[model samples]
Target: MINFESQNLICRFRGIVLQSILWNNDVKSTKYTIKEMIAHHSCLELPEGKSITKADTLEDLAQLYELDDYYWAVKNIHPLTHDLNYVL
Candidate 1:
């Protein structure tokens, strides 16, 4: 079990490193726009919740924005924006 966990961690780390390298290359090449990056990150489906309804109120709007920001920060390669050191 420990071996499996270690392997998973290593794989995930490699993926992150690869993603960072790709992002760096994109930044250098100017091939990827910030909007495209944001859109890519926002493609994830939110969890089932009443706050996600179309008829949601202003409070829901705030919550939704917060959720999007949190999701982007977590999925982003930058360490400063991430709340935790490790990926979820």
Candidate 2:
């Protein structure tokens, strides 16, 4: 299970910076290690504008674009194969 304790998630992935729009950093720590963080949210979002949560993976992230919770996030994603509604 995720720790749920508060944390500061900073993304410096491959030297690319990620500034979370919603201040996701200060929220609860879903995972404990930098490796874990990279494998999920910060790293992916910085480069691809896509991130995963405890309930999702990179593949799962694709499906999220169709959901209201993640639809807005697709605004910054270019070269998308689908339309605004994502239709994934």
Candidate 3:
């Protein structure tokens, strides 16, 4: 059970990392950590757009983009397949 939990955590972390890479590349302007990107997405603001000071809480973050939640939901897949998963 612990192993399974660890694997899940790894998968989720990897997924976040891959998603951060994609988001960074998609914008091609500012580079953001996974946390920052998640927060930005939660605020419904582009990384290159105006700064958001309201996404301080996880619930506040949750209201930004429905897509972000979707992204986090499957963040544990292989990195090579992230592009395909992200498109769907």
Candidate 4:
């Protein structure tokens, strides 16, 4: 379980530089990590938008993870081929 303080810190950090840092540092490995994270949490929802500040809790983080996976999956696979396993 994520503690409240840790969650807040995550939200703040992501809101500031999560995307920039992730995409800027080693795109291939970052994408792989995102894909794996989403695959591991196959039941999570993927919310729209580019802001990582959207995650307010562990549940929200799951959704954000899914969104990142979906974003990369769409780029790498046919839309029809991409599994909708996590869609709400």
Candidate 5:
């Protein structure tokens, strides 16, 4: 696993070319923060001040995604937006 400093954060989204198997809802395939996506798909909790390492490049993200089905293309988004969504 790549070690990451908390200063840099990365996100992901399912590639448009991948077909959604379940529903016709394309909304479910929209870009999502990697942290949120991982939290939902795995029991592992991200460290309090750590983020995915080597996620700075698309190649890295693709390799990470290949390791597990939880990842997708790299996306950059606000870290706190997940919490704000819950509050709103």
Candidate 6:
């Protein structure tokens, strides 16, 4: 993990890309990933304090969105978005 030490903090979404998926299934299966931006809320943790000790009390807030299904989660993976799951 990379560590940063700066009082003047700045963070931005570098955006997400399908990095690499060598092995997905338990038997190590390769599958073509289809990613489309479905309209929904996506919560991201604004960069935390320089050290872990200065973090907030609720870690849940970081992953919790206002409404999005949070596609990253296992249960929510297939149904990427809740109401609006279709590709635009």
lDDT of each: 0.36, 0.34, 0.41, 0.41, 0.33, 0.21
The residue-by-residue lDDT of candidate 3 on 1-88, one tens digit each, is 5477546643553554345444433322222443465354343254422322344422223233334554445444434453544453
Please state every model's RMSD to the true fold in angstroms: 14.0, 11.9, 14.1, 13.1, 13.6, 14.5
Off by over 4 Å in 5: 1-32, 44-51, 67-88
**Residue 43 miss distance in model 1 (angstroms):** 33
**Error of model 3, residue 68, in angstroms:** 22
lDDT of 6 by residue, 31-65 (tens): 11111111111212222212122322112222321
Candidate 3 off by > 4 Å? 25-88
TM-score of 6: 0.14
Error of 3 at 59 (Å): 29
Candidate 4 lDDT over 1-88, as tens digits, reads 9678646644643433345232333334443444344445432254322222344332243345444553455435543333333342
Across residues 1-88, which tens digit of lDDT does each residue of candidate 2 receive?
4333212333232111122212222212322233465656545445433343442432233233333334346445542553333455
List where candidate 4 sits over 4 angstroms from the true fold: 1-23, 43-88
Residue 5, candidate 3: how far off, in angstroms? Answer: 0.1
Better of 1 and 2 by TM-score: 1
For each candidate in turn, the TM-score is 0.26, 0.17, 0.28, 0.27, 0.27, 0.14
- Point out where model 1 deviates above 4 Å: 25-88
Q: What does candidate 1's lDDT look like per residue over 2-75, in tens digits? A: 47754664354334334433333222222123223323544213331222334132223323433334335534
Worst 10 residues of 4 by lDDT: 43-52
